[model samples]
Target: MSRGAQVGVATVYRRFPIKEALLTEAFAEERDRTLQLLLDLVRRAQEAGALRRDFVLEDVGLALMANAGIRAQSPEVRAEASRRFAA
Candidate 1:
């Protein structure tokens, strides 16, 4: 992990002692970026006239949650660190 990500994990660990808690907190950040990627996909779809403007952020979020590789190291730990990637 990069220094920034390491710091984020450290902060999370400080806030929550358990690794599972820390990973869950980190996963939320991952989810947000995944949601953004979905938003971009939606924008592209709209530009291509494939998706209607009626599509909302929630829809994008759901799409991302399903398609994005948001896998956890373990079911309990929920480590989405693999999703912490460079663009």
Candidate 2:
């Protein structure tokens, strides 16, 4: 993974300490990116008078929290669940 990222394997191990830690951080970064995109979309929708003015980013955050259980499933199931959840 570090090689693909053009980073040294030793540096990756040193930063993450464990594989689980690396996975956790990667998941967090991905989640953050998703949330940012959602926020931007929400803002654009609101500006366009599509979404309700009362709708907020926290609502999306809460929904993501509720959907967090999908992480416990197998990768294939998780991917499908995520697709459905987003839909």
Candidate 3:
């Protein structure tokens, strides 16, 4: 799923106070799920020679963070940004 599709999930995370004790714990499950999926895709990309062997989980984190930072004037633009990020 694209980041745009995850807006609700993101909103849920944002709802908790920044310093909430259980916030990290709550987000961990979703984070792990997303990480595993990214790892799977990375492995395939490597096998297809589209990605280098040096890729790591941290790169996935960085990519997600970068995508999250994207802002647009409208829903259509935001959706486009998510598609571009996925690509």
- State which candidate, 1 or 2, has the greater TM-score: 2
Which candidate model has the greater TM-score, 2 or 3?
2
Q: Which ten residues in a row have the lowest lDDT in candidate 2?
A: 64-73
Q: How many backbone clashes are present in model 1?
A: 0
TM-score of each: 0.45, 0.49, 0.46
Query: On a 0 to 100 scale, what is the lDDT of residue 9 in model 3?
Result: 54
Q: Cα deviation in Å at residue 37, candidate 3?
A: 0.6
Candidate 1 lDDT at 39 equals 82
lDDT of 3 by residue, 1-87 (tens): 227546565565566546574468778999899878988998999999998789887887788888889899998998899889877
Off by over 4 Å in 3: 1-19, 62-87
Error of 2 at 14 (Å): 2.4
TM-score, cand. 3: 0.46
State which candidate has the highest TM-score: 2
Candidate 2 per-residue C-alpha lDDT over 1-87 given as tens digits, one digit per residue, 9 for 90 to 100: 455788988889889999999999879988899888989999999999988889899888776886786774488888788889766
Score each candidate by Cα lDDT.
0.68, 0.84, 0.80
